[model samples]
Target: MKVDAISNDTAYYFLRQLGLERFNVKNLNAGHCAKARSWESKKAKGAWSMSRYAEPDENGEVEGVDGQNNNVAYLSRSNGNSPTEQLKKIGLSANKFTFLRMMRGSTLRALVPYLNKEQLLLAMRLFPKMLLVRLIGSLPKDMLLKMILHTIPLKKFLALFKAKVLFSIVANKRLNVREMVNGLEHLPREELQRLMTNITGSDTTQLNKPELLGMFRELDKLQLMNGLRKMGQEHFLEFVYQVTKKDPQLLMALPRGELMKVVNSMPKPTLVELFNLLPKSQLEQFVSMLPYKALLVALYQIDNKTMESLLVNQFPDLIAALAGDGLEAA
Candidate 1:
């Protein structure tokens, strides 16, 4: 049936009637669409409408006339078999059929703002089987349907539907923190660390103490402390004091290349913290020794707009800070 067939008043009234009867408002609306489509499709093939009958068959079986059955009446099966058996053989479960009808109806309503009555109706007719497969053959159909509904402009419909469906799904299946951390493995080191901090509920300034300690233990066991040191001083110190408790042997064993590498890999915030920990002379020397590339990298740690303003004003100290390392001439 065309979406336009169900006027707002009609839809509102239908929903109200369902609410009065204590049926789930969303489910009732979905069932209404299913009923409408079944009616329309049967009418298209010159079959009797449900309004003309008391109820569907008690056996959940379709009515038959010689070779024809109500449920499979539209299909022209070449094989000689009962229609119910044929439907079962094709894996058409009751829940799937119900979900198929609901998606078709929801899609129709979702397209109402963007489509004319004719286009909406045509899409409604075409999409049911595809939606059914996408819903049933993969993840939960309700989740997929909710995602589709969200992308559409039908916010009121989606709100009612989502309040009844999606909220429960998310609550039941909370996202895994470990899985979220592992998912960041391919990201750039700074980005990966940022994502890991976000996943573990750590702020940019303070790492998750427990999770970070655990991660450090793993890295230490793998003998990657040198690699960790090369990530930068803030990372190293944080790992040392916060995680490994400043183990003397571990500190002594750290190679200079590893320290530099870790420093280079640090996010700007952590780098700034490293700079803050250095004595004035050491900080000046470190800043002076930084290549233009390293200085540019450090600049990324600061806010972008602030950096832009700093560049525009040609701050002499900032320029001096970036000089040396042979890259100053370039």
Candidate 2:
């Protein structure tokens, strides 16, 4: 759009939509095309003017300019709609390219928060997946990931983000699991699981015990704690439980802080079983990292002699209370 032609209904509205800096319309009004100007009634109370000049078309619709006529109806509608919706609707064949190609980053980012699942899918279908992926890749990861996770269903998002599936499979075939994971930051979560399952020779049909354990160790190598954290504590615990239930020995692979968070979030039964599976050295590492309650529960599952030795080594004073009764009271 010409610098001088930005108007409240079109260019200015889009800038406002994306929260971009827009030229003041007063100064830029010099270039407002009269045809574009006539779409809106001068005295309309809102950003868009709805006027009927009544030079009806053959179809009896009020006449308007051919090329730059923007339907400002969306300007007044609700549901947190983008102004571009109207532009997209009427500008169908004409300026559709302009809306997508010339849109500012802020505008694109702004489009994310309000587009419902249906609209987002519609928009996704409008563009090629790679182009959409490139556009989405430009967004801040935290913001974009949250947008995909909370509002857009990950299954649907992955369906739209088919490259994540395609690229992940390609990368896994070419690179080691860690290499593939570390190399591609934008791979989808489900595809990451598929890759994990593929690498470990686990059945893709269902996640079995050995497969869960394999996923655990492999994802740990990928340093997936931060990503899991964003996936939510509930899902995080379920993920850990799957790993720990089948092969808790791999619990040692988790970073101390991440493991503590996982174990502490789990119920006592699961925490007990997971801790019981830890070997002596890893158990010691886990003991120091967990809080008093989780640590105490873990100790209850260890052999008396080993528990005593652990308590003596880690907390000498607690040894005295546990000396007589094998930790029934201490």
Candidate 3:
């Protein structure tokens, strides 16, 4: 299954269907609910700390509890023969949720290999972003490749490229440069062009597009990120535009001033297209970013049909309210 097989439409539909289901209290298992509540109480009491294992010595070895390292000692209690055995022992020793709650992010990362696909997906959704970063980093390079190529949708997977996440992964020395490059290689050529131009600070005019992209293979994630930082706002705006073209709502992720600047730079026609592309949920935010004068100007340029579509399709209540007020005035 190629990544392309899992279309954004399919993923969006799956998530939408999931969202459509209503919660039913009757479906809850009383035993499981009590256990969950107990986990929460323990969490609130700070009983979840991962301090059972001794701190490592200067040599990075924890003292002789069978000579296991800091990473393994707690999970195995210095007894288990393998990581799977260690995981099984730990799981058996306490409430499953409580045991998980006590595990550090790194320990959870170490457990990823023992998890099946459903378990991995659950971990991905439920883990905190910081912990997910570590868990994702811990995945074997080939496994990560397989997930990107066959499991995750392109749009959903690319959301991991946020600056903080990438910076943290690089800072922790967990970034797999080849894997990162391979992912980039899978992006559309136009996107790759925009990204490489920003990273290299050389447009297609300065270097052959392919030659510039070739440099991407030699760069590590850190350098690629730093190059983006040094690329200046203009290029960064273009990069953002390229990345968010299919999902205009993502433009809101930019700083308000930066987002306004990017939107303001567009011609009236382009701005109209952007407004049309934006989801209804984000319409208020997009409008809020524009000054009154700019907003009126952009709105004035939209044709009557487009304006009606925007009003009816994106703001049905607003249109109805305006019509009601017009009738009252009449």
**Best candidate, TM-score:** 3
Order the numbered candidates by TM-score, best leading.
3, 2, 1
Model 2: which ten-residue window has the lowest total lDDT?
321-330
lDDT of 1 by residue, 1-330 (tens): 123223334434433422322323343244434443454455446553333222223322222111112323222221344333333333222122222222222222221333233222222222223332331224233333333333333332223321223222212222222322232232345643553454444554454445543563444222332233234433332332322122222222233332233334334333333223223443333333222212211222233344334222322111211121111110
**Which candidate number maximizes lDDT?**
3
Model 3, span 127-245: residue lDDT tens: 22343333333434433333232433444443434554323333333335554454444445655666676665666655554665677878877777665565444344444334444
Q: For model 2, what is the error of residue 84's alpha carbon versus the real structure, in angstroms, after optimal superposition?
A: 38
Between prediction 2 and prediction 3, which has the larger lDDT? Answer: 3
**Clashes in each model (backbone N, CA, C under 3 Å)?**
8, 0, 0
Comparing 1 with 2 on lDDT, the higher-scoring candidate is: 2
Error of 3 at 201 (Å): 2.7
Ranking by lDDT: 3, 2, 1
TM-score of 3: 0.22
What TM-score against the true fold does each predicted structure earn?
0.16, 0.18, 0.22
